[model samples]
Target: MTPSESAAAASNDTRTRRSRLLDRVVGSLWPSMALHRATRLMAGGQAIRAFGLFARAARAGSAEAEYQVGRCYLNGAGVPVSRADGFRWIERAAARGHAEAEWILAALYVDGVAPCCDRQDSSGSPLDLFSFDVAPEPDFAAAEKWARRAAEHGSADGQALLGYVLTFGPKSMRDLEEAQHWYKLSAEAGCPQGAYGYGSSLVQSGDSEGDEVRAADYIRLAAQAGLSPAIYLLGMLTERGWGIERDQSAAVQLYRRAAVIGNRSAQTSWGRALMWGVGVEPDRIEGESWLRRAALAGDADAAALIGDIYAEAGALPPNYAEAAIWYRRAAEAGHAAAARTLGLLYLSGTGVGRDPREAMNWLGIAAEAGDRSAQVDLASLLLNDGASHPGDLAKARDWLERAAASGNLLAASHLGVCLLEGIGMDREERLALQWLHQAAREVVSAQYWYGRALSEGRGIEADPSLGRAWVARAAAAGMADAEAALAEMMVNGRGGPKDHGAALDLFERAAAKGHVGAMYALGMMRDGGFDVASDHAAALRWFEAAAERGHEAAQHIVGHSPQQNVRDDR
Candidate 1:
């Protein structure tokens, strides 16, 4: 070797020896170091040395050191994993009142992380180290005991976990009231899960201490802490203006945020907003995809919403088949609206084959489930002659009565008609008239009936003038019966001075709608020269047309009085 090469070799050997001496010094000092410094060493990649330090400190009765060593063993960090060693160290820290350690020990017991077993010799002889020869199962009683200790030690997370276990643990251990008490304490201590649990319970109880404001405040705190469920609930409250100012835009943003975190309910809300263009641009495909995601996640409302979207003829070309598919899905999930809609589809054969029996079955299900629309439809079906069992007027009346009592206007009208005709129940003229009057406020048929009754003094005082006005309103609303009735009233001047021209116009209008009575009246007017110049040919043609439609009066006049000028005025 030359002189420079020899000096370089000596320099490298000196540096190597110095590095080994520094490592030995550091490794030797680790066992005596404080927990924080040891943790920093572990963080700085001296895992082997830090593990030794934690073990030594734990043996010296340091609770934090024991907990760190236990956690490391549980996670197989810088040491071969040992469940028995982890439990022992964790229990030691817990015995020393280490809050997190108690919580971890409770979790270990609850999750059966390390089942206790006898340490037997290789000769299969039972060891005296522990009592049991077999592995011990999970002990929730032990978990609860340790969890209470942790909670009493002022661990917010421990209190929250204890609250959860008390509320949703095994049935034998559940205690909702106590759970709420713990949750309140944990939430006051600033635990996010505790805040969420307490807030959710309050919201579900309809009113918290008879005020929504307190519930909303807690929920807002949890939401601010980035809790997904709390965010979703706040969005709902914002959208509905419940304990908050209604803001569709803000609700949409919240729902979007929660949806990004995989909240199924928020996904459904976002999808519905997108589909309906409520605070969002309409995106049919994307909205439908999200809806499908929620439905697949078991949201019955999402399935029903999908059905409604497909059923709306204005929004999309009606796809009744697809609508039925989704409606059935929701129906199976006990959605009353979906069942009612499916029943209607069956009745009209819009999507499925027309099956009265199936329609009645579904309608019955919805009606019994308290769907007012379904009750009315089921009553109508029963009143008609097409039901599986020949029309059961008695049952139909009962259903109608139930629906009417529930404020169903159409059901009231049907009940009135039934009472008037004595078709189902015993006749009750006064009750029938009352129902007719109420129904006449909106329904054209009810208006016509009420007007006719008033004009004829049936079950009410005669009010021909008001009756004629009501009939006129119905006629303007395109009721053929009202038109024919008004035409006769005009011809007789029962309500006011009659105009023959107006009578003729009303007769023509009613006749054009295939009103048989209007046709007969028109023939009588033409033959008598009351409205126009007597045209026997036109009168005969009117008579023949009415007779062809099975009008008995028209048939009689056409056969017996072909050329006779017959005019009857009463």
Candidate 2:
């Protein structure tokens, strides 16, 4: 054996051991050193170098570095954005028990962010390397799992997010009591979202004054922290005097603050206040601008309110065309009152084409939504079209009954007429009289009908004097039928002394309103000289007018002899 060769081999082995020891020492300290350098580079805006260091640390199994690298990919800090890579890295960090990473994963799953490819083109623009057509759907179960993990690990942000998910998640997953519990814990840890959530819950479900006051306190805390929703809610509570002094002016101020930050509901309230000068000087232009913003954002109430403002004669002139536009928008979004108003516009040809079909469609929509006025209007339209649509009469009666049962006096009047005339059902004189009597207190037409019933003894004992008094009352209110009836009673002396001059005057008044019966009576009176000077030409003219209006007796008289003076038969 050569001693020199053995000594050289031993020296080589010692050098190898020393190099191995140095490599182990460097590996032990490299990740920590690289992580520190990355943080400093990030703070210095050296994103490219920071990302390199973060990548190195991540390869060494550093959770913080993995999270940072994920964020860099997500935000395009050092490279083109890539949500797929970002989510992968974040998921890895979350699996390693990083609380913040877990929370991020939970939020990402709940929000359903796009997961694009990791590739970049020569111009450094993101490319769809995976050819993905759509973003992945939200995974609520995964979100809950990550959120619970982060919350159990003492992350206040995670607690707040968990509470939100539990409170407003899908119907099957909602848990208000558990949500409140998480919110309380997070709020105690100084999370503004947690405070707002807890306060909203207490406000909605508070059982006592103390709970309401506590809710107000928590909401105030969130408002002071600049939470827009909390600010808006506090304004509502202040305006309504719920756990606070009523202060509409102060509430308007709060609404203004929230509105400026793009809260749609706050914008609506602020616009209403400004438009009506409820708690501020009227500013129609500014108010309408705010309302339009909310309406464009799909606020149904705001759209409907804008329609009302344009329709009403206020600071601005009424513009039914513009009102119809807004009403159509709100009605399409299921606003009942807006549908009803739009129906009336179509029915009357006011700022819209006169479309009976459209009117019935919109009126039916509102009626089905429980609008009593809509039901009554729909019934009237149906009844008026009975000749063309024979099936409509029964439907009209059904609608009238519904509205009348809901205490609509006009509906009761219409329904009573239908019963008495056998238009929709068998004649029910007793029911007709009862309904007419009930509606007569507020309805002029009902008053005339009730008077007629009393005079004819259709459903009650005849009381001609009382009937004459009622007809006189309705006549003074300008009812054409009532004027004619009262005039007949005066001429016949059925309930009072006859006054031929007064009866002539009453007949003339009713005829002016196009009452065919009044026209016939006037012809007879003039022909017989019962109320005025006899004039054959005037009698012929009155008879011809009544005949044109489909009066059978007047038509017969006209056919027999237009110039003949007929004797008064009354």
Candidate 3:
């Protein structure tokens, strides 16, 4: 190289160093100018040059520049990510009364981490970075302290965050009224999250209808701003006509909008609408796709609904195995109906192995959650297996009583039978009769038992005529026991005048239903020639039929009669 050229290069290097030194001196005296240039550079995507200017302004004690440097360090924007250094710089800016720094500091304390800068929009404003990550530990007290300071400094985002903390924090720190106050301020300042929070609070307040209307308006504002939760809630209000005109089609559209943005509740609602053709054309495949997405996102209700779709016999054959899988997922998530259905599946071995213990465990969970049907089913299981498990009879009675008190007729009938027969407890004739009568209005078995009790004068004064009428009602409904009992009453004239022809007819009807007692009675009438001309062959056949069914008297007659030997020879 020529010597002159090398000298010129050294001189240019000296000039460039002198120029940079002069610029730094000027920037120290006028930090705002440096900040402006840094912002411009950042807008142009020159992150390294922007960071250099921001650091120079921060060295000159500019609070905004200090915040910018902290954000760059935290977000790794042309700087190595360092949470400690970022926090220190942000604290310095916050202490110097930078409103944005105070807001960010409060958010850091609330979440125990910096908000992700990569989630910002094109305008460089943070989006909903509230739920992205969790901290090893959170400092709610510190968060509240900084948030209050930021809100007092008139930061709208700070006000909204303060409202959120107060509304959902620990019980001792929660203050709904205070939260509402901040939420209103933030909402008035154009914060969509604040609008949504305030609207939700008003909806749940149970105040006047006017408050609900106001809530709907606020929620609409948030929804227009593209808040997914607000959109979902507005859809619910629209569908139910709560503070809004009912429009199912519009509600479904709203659900679709929110669902597309990843709102799990909205996805579930939209899936249900599509599957059931509610305000939409039925599309089971598409509906199931949406539901699966929600279920994968940990939506218990969506999982249960998917289970129902598989279990129900519809356009496609029921898939019990798939239903059981979804039901188990929902059940593990505390879905009461899913637990009950899973219990039934286990009990019946429909999709899983038959496991009485597992069925009882799941059914007990549902019953304890106040499921009336589960209570009755659990009681029935206990009663059926009472002999195998000690104390099961008492537990069954308790469960039946609980279900009966909740207006379950099947439970009432079972409870009455247990009391009447002293199957689980001491007989309570009056209580048994009362329960039996109550259930008899709808339960055929209860009708038969109540009628038998009245005829025997077991609980109340014998009303033979009323007993005969009740038994007739049960018999007409095809109760085998009632038919046999009514026929005996007719033959003995216990309730009405004796009628041999009617008694014979009743006996034949009851015998056709496989009633062993009726078979024995028919054999007796034929053998004694009490109702018709003596027919020894028919009597022997009836006795044999009854004997095969374990009727003791019929067995004795068939075994000892010489006519039996003649019949066998024939």
TM-score of 2: 0.75
Stretches of candidate 3 off by over 4 Å are 1-38, 48-155, 169-175, 383-403, 406-408, 421-427, 471-570
**Candidate 2 residue lDDT tens string, 160-240:** 889988987888888999999998998999989889999998987899999989899899899999999999999999999
Query: Which has the greatest TM-score?
Result: 2
lDDT of 1 by residue, 23-140 (tens): 4555455544556656887899877667877877777678999999998888888898777778889988999999999988887777765554566678998554333456656677
Residue 294, candidate 3: alpha-carbon lDDT:
94
Task: Rank by TM-score, highest first.
Answer: 2, 3, 1
Candidate 3, residues 373-476: lDDT per residue as tens digits? 88888887776566356566676788899878778898998888878888757799899998899899989989888888898888899988888878888888
- CA lDDT, every prediction? 0.82, 0.87, 0.87
Tell me the spans in candidate 2 whose CA falls farther than 4 Å from its real position: 1-183, 314-317, 379-406, 418-435, 454-473, 488-503, 532-535, 547-570
Residue pairs with clashing backbones, model 2: none
Please give the distance, in angstroms, between residue 395's alpha carbon in candidate 2 and its true position after superposition: 8.2
Better of 2 and 3 by TM-score: 2
Candidate scoring better on lDDT of 1 and 3: 3
